[model samples]
Target: MGARGQGRPVAVIGAGAVGTSVASALARAGRPVTVCGASRRIERIEVTEDGSTETWPVAQATVPDDITGYDTAVLAVKAHQTDAAAAWLKAVSAPGTTVLVAQNGVEQRERVAPHTDGAYVVPAVVYLNAERTAPGRATLRRVGRWDLVLPDEAPARALAAELSAGLMRVGLEADFATVAWAKLLGNITANPLTALTGRRVDVLRDPGIGTVARLITDEAVRVARAEGAALSAAHAREVLAWLENAPEGATTSMLQDRIAGRPLEYDALTGAVVRAAERHGIDVPVNRLILALTSAIHPGQ
Candidate 1:
């Protein structure tokens, strides 16, 4: 099936870097697409992946009512913006529709299910490193091979087929919990550390900071295993290594939010790990401290 999902319309919520990139991919695949809640009204979306650029014309809708008959909605808003984007969720979540949540953190279903009107929620582990350069422009800085990881379910498989276009490669994993938790492990450490220090990806190479990151990841690994995510100490080390080797001068979403003076997404990233640790009676001093400090810096959360 196409991105329209058997000829039904498809909509992308949020016009941030990730949203625009996905929209560009779908449009490039000859799928009928619409973008809702764009930061600005634009007729085109431009995404530069690696060193190549692709542009596609898209229908832009500012209000939920303007978009109807959408069978698939790719939600790309930040964790903190979920509540604010609830209206768009309701609009596209017609009965039996699928909402593909392309956000950070592992609690994508929990965070989004409440807002949808009984629509099927498919959580996606997004691996794309996209940055919005302007209103309708984004750059996909390649950090890994795949762009998304979803559960090995019918909805996910269908969604993956529709999204296999351009640079948007998708993977279906039988053990999605492990994949989600592993991705969270990287974000739980890298995002907060960079935001707090006002530094780029290379800051993780500092000895003292590296030690703190390891501690945070170690604690999170315990939480992940407790939550049945098959994580180990070796995985923690791998997370640190991946971040340390990321392109120099690369900024995390949390660091970008700090620079823009917007609310940080620590609650969903670090805060989620802390919450799970509490349930399992696990002591997560590093993660808890990082959560506290990052929470203080966020605007409203």
Candidate 2:
């Protein structure tokens, strides 16, 4: 079915930067889209791309009970916020629905499967670099080739075809575990350090910080390989280079959460690496230290 074939609205959970951007893209492509969030009233979602901002008058539903229908849904909340978003997931997901988990970490399927009733949950690796400047507003800073990467499966292929008309592009990969782990390497390296230092992507330019980032990448690469992802030692350097080359002053989701005093998502990024390392009996001192420091910053969250 195409964008308008089934007459079913596409639900995007979480009004954060990623969610707003995805909703805006799909809406611009003429797909019926509903943005379900925590807002008490309908809000105009705006996304700025290539110096131009556009507002989408998509359907809005804030309450979980109000989100009772949708054939496809994107769960864009942070890993730590999964519990809070469970109600919406349950309301929109059923046997025929397709729920795409667009959050961080390598455990997207495991993290979101329980929340979605009988709907097929597709794990996605989001490659977009956008930030929620304010409520209902997000700016896309990078002009990347694809916004999401998914496995080469029937569900993922169908979702990719659905999004083909939008600004968001989806790539189907045969080895999705490797792709997810590669992205996770970027997260575990950039996120924890940036949140801890209260800096942006440029912080990796510092020699000391760069050293720590490499150490973190090395550990994560090892853990990712152990977890059946095809990552190499050279991939560590490539991940660091990618982070260092990001747009100047670009902020990560973890850094944004830190600035807002919200709970850090280190448990998903750094915590994922550490957990895998423990299971494989690998030594990852730097990753363990970063996880501890980030978790302490927002204790009990």
Candidate 3:
């Protein structure tokens, strides 16, 4: 709806909640959206919230051959699934293609760009509370907004305008690393803690759990600073408080993975901090413990 790109298509790869909602956003903007899932199990993408449902009848592409022309492909799969996107990336990504990497943590461009050559890859931090119930049905559990934060760049500006035309709010970030790491701090506690205890974000409100959660953020802040992320140690306390006040029924993607018997992204979220801390000679024992404990539960190896 922003600019009719001369017949160039926009594809959302992965049928997960984030990807589904993004496709819905584009569809609501009067864009003909293409959805490429792991399989062709879905015929419709339903986004529901507060007893209201918005359904999009999308063109389904389960394999590379089923996919058509596209200029932008939003990589909405988990970090671990980036490897799985290699085939699809090679098929749809042409010269001048822009792939939006929408996933948790940082280094998204590093993981996704290599699979497709001659494409401008962008990284975006997504804020959403949606979960897939059926193959095509995703429940927008929280009645909030969907948003994307991207570095201030030419392509990112275009993407922001395009998504903002629909049901999304876009923010431009001059210091993208800090914004990304700051969001990562918000994830470290809820992700690992919920996955371990099999509880929702409500666990963070407990006095004892809240203390440990804050400590994890504190350590992650040290790692973020060492990486020149421009995050404040004070923000660590804020992250803990924010989680404590979040919706009681909210759950992280990592927790969803554990509950669904899928692979957890501990390596990308908390484990990322530990790896960065080791490289910078910083001590992050709190992160190390949670990472170790999470790995014990989900050895994704």
Model 2: lDDT of residue 103: 92
What TM-score would you give candidate 2 relative to the actual structure? Answer: 0.94
Candidate 1 local lDDT, 181-216, one digit each (tens): 999988988899989999987999999999999999
Superposed by TM-score, candidate 1 places the C-alpha of residue 11 at a distance from the truth, in angstroms, of 1.2
TM-score of each: 0.94, 0.94, 0.93
Give a tens-digit lDDT track for model 2, residues 1-301.
Answer: 2332334678889879998887776676666777787564545788887789999776778678776756788889999999888889999877777888889999998988788868999898988899998877899886346788988989888777766667578899999999999999889878888888889989999999999988888888888888999999898888788888887668899989888888889989988898899999999999889988988996333
Ranking the candidates on lDDT from highest down gives: 1, 2, 3
| Candidate 2 residue pairs that clash | none
**Whole-model Cα lDDT of every candidate shown, in order:** 0.84, 0.84, 0.80
lDDT (tens digit, per residue) of candidate 3 on 148-191 = 78889998888777777775777888999998998899888888
